[model samples]
Target chain A: MGSNDLQKQAPNIVVWVLLLALPLWLPYVGGYMELGSRVVVLALAAMALNFLLGYTGVLSFGHAAYFGLGAYGAGMTIRYLVPSTGVGLLVGTLVGAVAGAIIGPMIIRLRGVYFAMVTIAFAQVFYFIAFRWNSVTGGDDGLTGWTRLPIHLGFTTIDILHNPVAFYFLVLAVFAVAVGVMAWLLRSPFGRTLIAIRENERRARFLGIPVDQHIWISWTISCAVVSVAGALYALLNNFVDPRALYWTQSGDFVIMAVLGGMRSFWGPLIGAAIFVVLQDYLSSQTENWMSFVGLFFVLVVMFFPRGILGIIRRKVAS
Target chain B: MTQVVLFNVFNGLIVGAFYALMALGLSLIMNLSGVINFAHGGFLAIGGYLAFTLMPYVGFWGGLVLAPILTAVLGLIVERVLVRRLYGRDPLYSLLLTFGLAFMFEDGTRFIWGAQSLPYQVPGWLLSPLSSDYFFLTGYRLFMVVIVALAVAGLFYILNRTRLGMRIRAGTLDLETVSVLGVNVRVLRNMNFGLGIYLAGLAGVLAVGQLGLQPTIGSSLIMPSFVAIIVGGLGSLPGTLLGGLLIGVASGVTTVFFPSATEAVMYVMMAAVLLVRPRGLLGEEGRF
Candidate 1:
């Protein structure tokens, strides 16, 4: 058991090292700072989704609603209400978390595909709002004319707006805090209950755990974190649109989590990284990139449903 | 004021019928097989596009009969080659597979037919309103409703009376029992899938005459179909049909007072249904 623990820690350490040194090494490998930042932001969203999907075993295909809310919240705050980036993030996260909590009750009783189907259907409400409420949401053209402000500390100011490297670190720092909290929670008793529920709901229910409540809590946490990622996505692009909340975007996030291997903690992050880079390359290469992306989904489900990390873990176990 | 309300409500009923048409097909596949066919909208698009290609050669009526058949044939092949493997596995794999297929279908249609929306011409006589006072009552709209009504009646007749329909109904109720009775479960699922796809194709042919043809035409209608199934009740075709119309009328009414919320109304209805009746308006208990 001690040896196994050490082995797990070793890979985690290597992963951290790679992530930490990404911005410094990325430019040398033909990757820009913004690309690195995009990956971190998207990976954070995927990881957040995996908390509910991979860990709690709740399948939510409409996470993009909260994610879009976060983006719109942050963007709207920065554009209309407040000019501070920190406040934008706070408001964005709050909006997403609150919405998830409110919507939780309606979907908690549903399990498996029904839950997913309802979630996807509900997400369209937000998409329509964003698309139709043009006066406030800027309609289908997307929210524009707003840019992320530079961070102002007590002693120093970080020009994240101008400096791509600074923005990458800022995203990485938030990712670290959010991912750390999730990892810590997973090791706690409450987290164990979640895992139990995921493994077998009936057994967990028999063990006197309140299954629905745990799932609701897990779902809210996942949404909150994904919203934070959404806020970051808006900050990175300095724009938010109805497309951000579209059902297709939700599918993309699911593919990221599945492609990364839902069982492993860092799997979604890796999945996000590969997906982002591949999508970037594909869009640049062909007009029919959507088909290729769709093909990727088919191929992944058919051949690598276990994901990259899953296959690696299997090899090691063998 | 009455005329405006009547116009939207009447419009809503027509739209609702279209939703019912699509939802019935989706519900059939989801009921018999545990897989939710996310690519259903894609098949609808294929149906519409196929009709468009064939119309120039076979005329509008000929294309109407043949296009859905072609779409169902394609659907049968897909069920056999791709979807069949995932039936015994987790529902997630099938959803993902179909989601991918949907993207392929949409992109494929866009690749074949230009992304620009194509005009589908109906007969000139059907283009004009039946009466001046009820100018909203175009001959085309009436024809579509009549055709849909006939198709739905045909579907129910087949389901209640025909051998294949009985097998499908039995499979949906208890596949294990049907298999125990020496029914080939694989062939049953494949045929059921083809039947559902056939409905989608029919919807495509009917819909394009009114809404026109575009790669995204099917996608726009799909969420409402899901809502329809949910609102009507899971595992109940009558419920799906009812749910589609209810939301359609709901949206149409809302359009009079709150035009912006035309699309959002159905989601609101879905939420209310889930809250008041989680099983749905007509859904069976323990089906989900």
Candidate 2:
């Protein structure tokens, strides 16, 4: 029983070990600290999406709206309201979460393609606002002139602004907490019910679960976590743009979730790592990288729908 | 003030016609195949580009006639090769596949044609204003509306009177029963996809004449089409048509007043429609 339990925990342990050592090995592989931070941030977003998509059986093609909102919230807060990084992050998260909660009731009853279409359409509202609201959002130029502030823990200051390693660590720390909460939620009874709904919604409804309400809660939670990732993303770049809220950006998160193995806990992380590295490499290599990335999506959907982890699990099981 | 309103409303109707054309294609595919076809806009771009490429050889009318047919052929091939494999699987795979195709289509168009927006030339006669007072009512704009009306009329006629159209409608309601009744469901779906792409192609050709030709043109237009579908009601084609025109007029009117809110007004209308009727103004209940 103990050995079996260890086997189940093996992927989690490996994932944590690799994430912790990313900054150390990344440079050796011709990658940078910022790249590592990006992988983690994107992985968090993908996993948050997978919580509702893979676990709850709901798909949101508009998650980038909350993500963009979180980024803009953090950026604007730092640029206009407060220079404190922590406060900006908090406010950014609240803004995204609140928006998600409000939008939840409007879309929760929709299923499948209709749900996706509405989410994509709803996200455009935010995108256009960011694009057209020139005075506040900096219009097409994006929010600029604001940098992520250093942390002052009373006795000492962590100069994350100047040091890439400090910023990477800070990102990792937030990622760990957010991932931990998601893991905990998935293991709880609430998570089990979510999985039940995923497997068969009609059966779950017959079993007396408040399916729509649960989905709404799951959707809200996923949006909040994704918003946290968005906040970190803004701080990492110290900028925010409307492209972050575009529907294509949401597609990226979904691709990461699918590429990693949406069914597994650590799958999206693996997907994010591969995707970020590939994108970084491809974009550097050519201007036609969008075509290649699009081609990659097609290939993955056609041949690798089970994802890296899913394929591995099947091989092991066989 | 009334003249300005009239001008904007006329402009809105033209824009709404384009939206309705695209939305009708999208609605057809969504209803029959249960696939949202995120690459619909990409296909539209292809149609426009094809028309542009064919213009030097065939002239304007010839390009219009041939571009949509060629685009429909491509659509048929795409459905057979890529989209057909995932019909029974989760809808997520198909959505992702088409989303990728959209990226490819946009990038492909950019690579083939320059990224710079190109002029789609209409005949000199078509460029002139119809009246001295209402300069906005150009001959080309009027022609576009007429073509849209004819195309829409033809589409309804095909769906209501043709055997293939009957099969499509029947399949949409119950695919299993239709297949059991010996209908070639695969062929039905493939042809349905082709028909839908034909409309997108037509919209693309018409759109370039008004908006000019750009790689991002399809993506820009796709969202409003989605809005049109949602506002029209999911299962009903007529509802989609109404939804498209309503939003177009709403945005046009908004342009007359709050210029900045022109793009946002349709979304506002959509939100209102969803909040009050959820199924949409013309949408049938339980269709989604």
What are the per-residue Cα lDDT tens digits for candidate 1 across A1-318? 599898879878988898899977898988888889999999999999999999999899999999999999999999999999999999999999999999998999999888989999999999999999999999999999999999999899999999988998899899999999999999999998999999999999998999999999999999999999999999999999999999999998999999999999999989999999999999999999999999999999999999999999999899
How far does residue A36 in candidate 1 sit from its true spot (Å)? 1.0
Per-model C-alpha lDDT, please? 0.93, 0.94
Q: After superposition, how far is residue B63 of candidate 2 from its true place, in Å?
A: 0.7
TM-score for chain B of each model, two decimals: 0.98, 0.99
Per-residue lDDT tens digits for candidate 2, residues B102-196, read 99999999999989999899899999998999989899999999999999999999899999989989998999999999999999999999999
List runs of model 1 lying over 4 Å from the truth.
Answer: A1-4
Given the true complex, what DockQ would model 2 score?
0.91
**Chain A TM-score of each model, in the order shown?**
0.98, 0.99
Worst 10 residues of 2 chain B by lDDT: B279-288
Q: Write the per-residue lDDT of candidate 1 for residues B1-288, one digit (tens) a residue.
A: 998999999889989998999999999999899888999999999999999999889998999999999999999999999999998787888999999999999999999998999999888999999899888999999998898899899889888999889999999999999999999999989998998999999999989998889999888999999999999988999999999889989999999999999999999999999999999998998887
